[model samples]
Target: MKSILNRRNVALSGGPSRLLAVAHDAATQRTAAASDAAAHDPHAASASGSPADSVVEIESRAEPAAGATLPGEGASGPRPVSTLHAVPVMPAHLNGRPVQIADGAAFEALRAADELTTFRVYRCFAYTVSLFFHPPTLGYFVALHQESVLWRALKANDLDAAGSAFHLMQEQATRLADGETRRAQLVAQNAELARLIEESETQAERLRVDLQRHSEQEQTVTGRQHQVRKEVAQLEAQRIAAQAQLNKAHRALHQLKVATSEGVPHLHAR
Candidate 1:
């Protein structure tokens, strides 16, 4: 067995350091190249200058070197790194947005506002067994989350702090989900209220139309009544005039009869 294949390294450090992840796709090519190189060059079979059994280098620096390939990264080149307070934990993207990690009062604001990520990079170690045969394409596999003390603890290998951050993340996720559900409920309620208002307005419009129709009918009936009363009054006046004419004729006939009778008696006496 090749000593390179047989041996492996796990790295840890106290205090503060940054975590760099290996890219998955380029990981396979590096080992195969080493194996091919050994097969071609007899001198390369010694494995003296070979990488230190996939050991990740941990060292103190104020900030990570830009575009620096992690030791043993080979063709994968420099690993990408982000800043965390003292201990480093990169952030993950959620809902297509990269989570932001702010330090000091800004991070406090995120904690108070509850707009932070829950994911943490607790451990960055080779999965072993399989790494000897078939290493994952990416050399370093870890996590990213924003503005978490728990993340720093995880980086420093603090088990208790990591656990606390895990629980807090779960709670925040629950709260956000509940808030979204409540908003949906309120929207449905508003729609229902608007529908009811529209129905009431429609009913009111129908009532107004009926009232107007009734008013027009009442006006027609009132006009008809006035016409009928006027006709009655005119008829009554004609009837009174006819009565007066009849009385005048009756008086004339009575006077003429009396005059004829007196004249006939006078003739007889003569």
Candidate 2:
């Protein structure tokens, strides 16, 4: 009976040891599979950590506004802006047409016309003074008037009128100078004529006295007549020379009058 009881206890203990070994092998296999899964999946936590740690990391990555700075971004700073006011522009006129005088041509035209008008008025005043103070200065007044006309035409930008007026004024000045020269020559001739008349009177008186003395003394009458004839001849020659000079002066005067009449009627008539 003792041997049978020992056999039964040994069989039960052996069976329990085998079951414990199998359970330990199965637990090891499960633990190895869990480790493999965790290694494959990046979202999976380690055996030592909980799921809450992974949640916190995900939230930190998504919510980047939590005291995190992005690349190439900065806070606000100061900048500048303009506050100056702009100026206004004025317009100008050309001919009879109204236009903006912005460019060179338009500005030049406007400025030239304004300056020309002022010059014209000043010239007219000068001419008026010349006319009143000096009548012989009519030639200068006429010239100034003609120049005013030319500048007026230039102010209007008319080249043709200005050229024609300039030519006319030059002709007038020439005529005036010619007239003055001829008048001076005539006055010189008149003086020469007066001198000749005085010389002829003196020669006549001398001849009369010689004739009377010869009549009183017949012995020397022939010599006295010869001397008187010689004196008369010299006086006649001087008178002829004076007449010739007078005639030449008259001819020059006539020619100048004709030229003046044709060239400048205004000054000549004045």
TM-score to native of every candidate shown: 0.30, 0.22
Q: How accurate locally, in lDDT, is each candidate?
A: 0.46, 0.46
Which lDDT tens digits does candidate 1 get at residues 1-270? 232222211212222112332311223445566677888985875654552233322112111432343354535655458775786665644333333332345434544565444434222121110000002221111222333332321121233433444444445444545666688789999999999999999999999999999999899999999999999999999999999999999999999999888867445555
lDDT, candidate 2, 34-140, per-residue tens? 56777797456365454444434433333323223323233342334779898776333333423221233433444455422222222222121011111221111
**Model 2, C-alpha of 1: deviation from truth (Å):** 99
lDDT of 2: 0.46
Q: What is the lDDT for 203 in model 2?
A: 98
Clashing residue pairs in candidate 2 are: none
Best by the TM-score measure = 1
